[model samples]
Target chain A: MASKGTVSVEVSDLRREFKGKGSPVVALDGVSLKVGQGEIFGVLGPNGAGKTTMIRILSTLLLPTGGWAKVMGFDVEHEPEKVRRVINMASGAEKAGYDFISAKKNLWFFSQLYGIPTATAEKRIMELSEMLGLTKYLDRKFYALSTGYRQRATIARAFVNEPKVVFLDEPTIGLDVMTARSIREFLKEQARRSERTIILASHNMAEVEAICDRVAIIDKGKIIAAGTPEDLMRSLGAPALVMEVSPPQSGFEMLSRVEGVKGFTASTEEERGLSTVHIVVETDAAARAAEDAVKREGLKVVASWRKQATLEEVFVALVGRGFKEREEQDVV
Target chain B: MKARALVRLWSIFGEPLWIVVSMGFPVLSSLALSLLYYSIGAASYVGFAVLGGVMVSFWGNVLWSMASQFYWDKQEGLFEIYLTSPAPISAILIGMSVGGIIGTVPSALIVTGIGWVLFHPAVNAVWGGVILTFGLTLASLYAMGMTLSSLYLAYGREAESLNEVLQEPVSMLSGLYFPSLGARSPFPLAIQAAASLIPLTIGMDALRKTLFYGNDIWQVWPDLAILGVMAVVLLFASTYALKYLENVGRRDGTIGVRIR
Candidate 1:
């Protein structure tokens, strides 16, 4: 972690409402948070949780209907051009100038927008391409690249200006696992080695937990929870311990009645013939107490262990439903 | 940067060129109409020939310009990208107009040349200079297209419906295919008035009066005057409209929403 100043991003009660066909949708309702410099801050939420809205406002692509947000002390709405100069955004929605020019030309054009000298721009492009594995396709037309390469190109374009702050909205959405992992690693390296501030909006729990210094979970266009990933999972309590009962267990009805258990249920899929059980425990003693009951009953436990609750589990426990459930919440 | 912007301009124009090639109906209709009039042997041979040539250039210019320039941008999702960048909206729109002129210039020349070859139209050299007014007319025409494009930005999801509804009515009212100046009925009068009020139509009228009838530039000052007014007013209106639309789009959480 780098020693930073007061704040890199200070979003103060920002509000954005969208006028739908029927009622006005409150895309972001009085959302507020602060991200320190040189940190990877993640915004986690289900689809349409106003993640993109927040990123847009921060990037100066959209303005808040109420309140204010400042990037590096510059107000987004009032000083959009200044904000634009200091930051760049890459999203799945980014339409590269495909069918129009080569990727290198695209990089050169954006470099001009940042007012970088030609020599420096070329050097930066070479560096970014090498780092992102885009050198092989730099001269290719944008439409010719695969989705993974295209996204890498977009990431390179976002950093061509050496922007102080980078906003990546769903940077790894729809990517293959390996590609997503590489992108996450690249983002982490960019933040750690270059000391750049990043605000990543994503629904991928593992990616957010692995890379983020702090995660803010947004639901219904509001930040429902904010903390480090470990802190959040810890706060959600010991998540449900999942285990597979092998060797064709006929029934597990007695598993629910175990002492110290808050609640328990099990269902079997006939094709797989594996019975899965979900148990809620009153305390740490409950898991141990329930395990003993299972063994005493002479049921072989194919696998048993206490694993840390993932961000996804923590989210479901908090929201009474998963993030995707609230996607239709009036936040555009 | 200038070269890159120029390339973007070319790429956007390229899609519309395909449309112009695909739609041969309009050109055929214009030539057919010319053949009908020529076969009828209607009055003043010189007048008909020159008038017919001017009309073809006017219609060909406007139709090809509209479909190839503004329509293609809306279709390709390029407008969203154009709006998101730091480039001034006016520059992008102006660039589109320049590309449009480039795309349509060939068609206009071809259509006019065909009319001349087939009809052996008598053209007055003095009146032909009126084509220079294309510069002013194009500026105002581009502004009008941009004004409509602002509406597209504001209504992101409904952009297609809005764009589709506006094209035919605007072209018809602008009198791209007929002698709007002589229209006498109230409906036709309204169309003529609208055409005369717009810079492109006015400029086209000047070219027709001059080339076909040998009228001097001074005789067509009325049309030029209208064009000058439309240019100033439309330019300001277009700029103001786009600025307002952009601000509204930002607030509604759809600033860069892809219309296509």
Candidate 2:
């Protein structure tokens, strides 16, 4: 470990390119960022946006074609062994550990790889299994455990060494809501208790918003924005307003005409004869103005509420499109 | 260290049936081949056939148990976990090789016991040279297997097919069933030259010379020296290959690829 106050992860002009059919595809393009010790940093991006690539680089699993990155003050390229000693990663890309072995046995084997003494590893495994609600499942073979339990085992494996930095790439993908919530809570508790830097790369916006202290939105292999979740939503400079109107309003032209109402999106429910409109305004007064305009238009207001912009809205506003849209475009 | 070794050992022996098949295959082949040699009026070659059978078993262990384990671990996503650990790759391979040896011992013993009982071949009586030759042969073969694994790691799914492609050809070229020495041997000049590149050939020839021919250690120094050199060269080559291929795999985003 470096000093207590030192940056845990640092990257500058980092680039990783893969050979494509015609030319090289840049997975990471001049990406640079820093994460402080004990910080829960989130990397949010669509498919093919290089979130996994960046995690791989920082965790010493991949080499950068250009520029540099350092994890825990150890250069990833030159000091890979040192970096590996202090960091661990878990990803949803694949299930790790031997299928024939018990989950506890898998954790023990990995702890051996890290040179953790057997006694200490056993103790740690018990503690983690208890904390993650995995104690009963630890004796089951990895193949026999459910997906959620297998994922929990993988997470426990990553923390076996009590690493200074942990890289989690969508650790909760495809799990049921309760399972996902449990993992998120475990991560939050770990971050708070150990003060270990956690770099979480995920597609779950709500999960990131709930647990991450800061987040970076990456698009097209570049980070478009990085800030605290609140700061990012605030940076949008517009409060979100959701309004339900009866009679299925023909259009949202009147609300759009309201002062400081930058834009509004409307969806209609034909069965319920109701139209729901989401209006973005620059201020609270603008929200009131939009409500008055809707009322003056002779549309019955069934319900209305003012709310802060969510991270998903902030991401769409900054990236100029929804995450799924970009993912589909990239696939084509 | 102890834990890794135990895990490797348990991984193979935990299922007794796999070990039974692994050991039975070679012994059965040895019995059939020795009978064929006896029926052909080459009764004295029973020792040669037995040695070939044992060596074949060793080669099979190297290919499937040792080499293919790399592919399995990669496919199972355990390789990446191994890489992230502070343990050196060499340590892991060594543990695996030791386990493979332990798991393959029954086959070796069965072949040796059957040959001794059926043929009563002349013993060297020089246990020192025999044991030394045996150890060197295992070391060289393991080194070669490690090198092969590096290629397999890079090749991914194609590695399984490649293993099949290489198995019989290597067995033939390395004289697993027939002696490569003597002028009447069927192997041609070019074939012999190519087979010599395989460490197992050198090891098997040396082991046969020292054990069956009652030769002294010094008499087989050249063969032992060649195997030692091959072991060193292949070990270094394997290390470099593993590192280079890992980088290329990472660059191609194929490190965790499990399509096959």
Candidate 3:
């Protein structure tokens, strides 16, 4: 394992810009991050947030326009080959080893590129295929496989080298729920078993929270917040508690009258014979009192749930609600 | 390291023997058609078969190999995997170059065998083997082809247009089909002389002299020297140019970036 204090990846005031005939547009604006060895670090952002660009730079595939990054104690600009040796990258946009060849042959070719001996490469390929559930389709052509299978093969390819650092951008994008979960579990296993440093860039909140030990939400080429999932959720303050009931509930009306209750909104569902009441609970404990009042009144409580703020909410709050559609709006 | 490079080449082209066969067939057809017209003259027939029929095809194979090999890799995503690996960029290029040779060798032998059967051509056996022109020519042409392939990544879809534009000029200047008639006017002569200095032309000329005219190796030393120099120079130049292009492509996100 790497020494606890030693950073596996370090970015210092890094910036990247795409030069055009008219004006260069900055993709990263003074972005910086330091990830320790064996940690699952995540950079969460919507489209056009420079997440992929940062991953590319750290993987030694792209050069920074300003500042610098070091991977495993090697400067990205001066010692790229060494940086490349220690890390492997998988991006959603990368569709490699797919045409006119079997997935196994592609992996075998990559194994040679990584300098793995022939025997060792075959053994590793078998092991990865089994772990990633690709044994049956190993002989099949890449284009014939589903997106999930292709992605699983890609994950196996990334870890086949057993490098100390790995970058995965949107590892689970476009995958079914079960496949996404399996991939997340596999990534977690890799981090633990190999002591590999992982940098996952994705917009999937649940997947990111499930695997990432720490996450930085990036917006407008800058990180808005960086912390564990719980800490980030807590930073959003007390959540609003909303309840749906079968009959009109008079108890919640009382709770809203209490000093801590800020306000209440109610809407009745005529088809289901249910009234949905959303109350703004000023304090964390108000959710409990509201639940008690609903029970005391003997109302048929269909669902009583706190609207717990999630990473998605955090992203929207920091990056804005129209992040998806307006990513390229202010490219200047 | 050389062994590893060799293994890489074998993996790339081993099973797909058809790719090489397809490239060779057109050249063989050209020779067969020529045979239907001109009875293979017995004099210097072996050299003529090797040089005249196959030599031009050999150069054409080099061009096709360059565009096809990396262009296939570019389409397949192998290029990105290659760039990300610990292996030096030169290793991959050289490995592919070696495979290109393997792919082209069968066609060379076929042209030679067909000529002997049809023409009963005379060849200065001792002089032909001593010159080593054929090997030098193949190496130089392979190097030149690879250098052109590297430019494919930077130009994107424009690579096809760029390649088409260079096709006529490269063939005309290389002079595989027509002899450099030796500088009547400084323009065509200068071009021909420069073309004669290329390894393929030298190799082709040396083979023509040895097989057709019954000349020995000593009689064609100049061709050997020119072929040797061009091969070494182009090999080194191609290797360096490919590495430079790979580096630039990665920075621009062009290596694996999708056009759509």
- Residue pairs in steric clash, candidate 2? none
Fraction of true contacts reproduced, model 1?
A: 0.30
DockQ sort, best first: 2, 1, 3
What is the per-residue lDDT of model 2 for residues A253-301, given as tens digits with 9 covering 90 to 100? Answer: 7765678776666778999999987776778898899889988888889
| TM-score ranking, best first | 2, 1, 3
lDDT of 1 by residue, A209-299 (tens): 9999999998878888888999888885666665556545655556567665544445566677665555555467888777777767676
Candidate 3 residue lDDT tens string, B84-189: 7788766676766776667566666677677667665555455554446566667667666666666666566665566667656665555444444343222366
lDDT of 2 at B81: 85
Instruction: Determine which window of 10 residues in candidate 2 chain A has minimal summed lDDT.
Output: A1-10
Model 3 RMSD in angstroms: 7.1
DockQ, 0 to 1 scale, candidate 3? 0.29
Best-matching candidate per TM-score: 2
Which pairs of residues collide in model 1?
A27-A331
C-alpha DockQ for predicted model 2: 0.47
Better of 1 and 2 by TM-score: 2
Worst 10 residues of 1 chain A by lDDT: A323-332
TM-score of candidate 3 chain A against the true chain A: 0.78
Cand. 2 TM to true fold: 0.87
CA lDDT, every model vs. true structure: 0.68, 0.83, 0.71
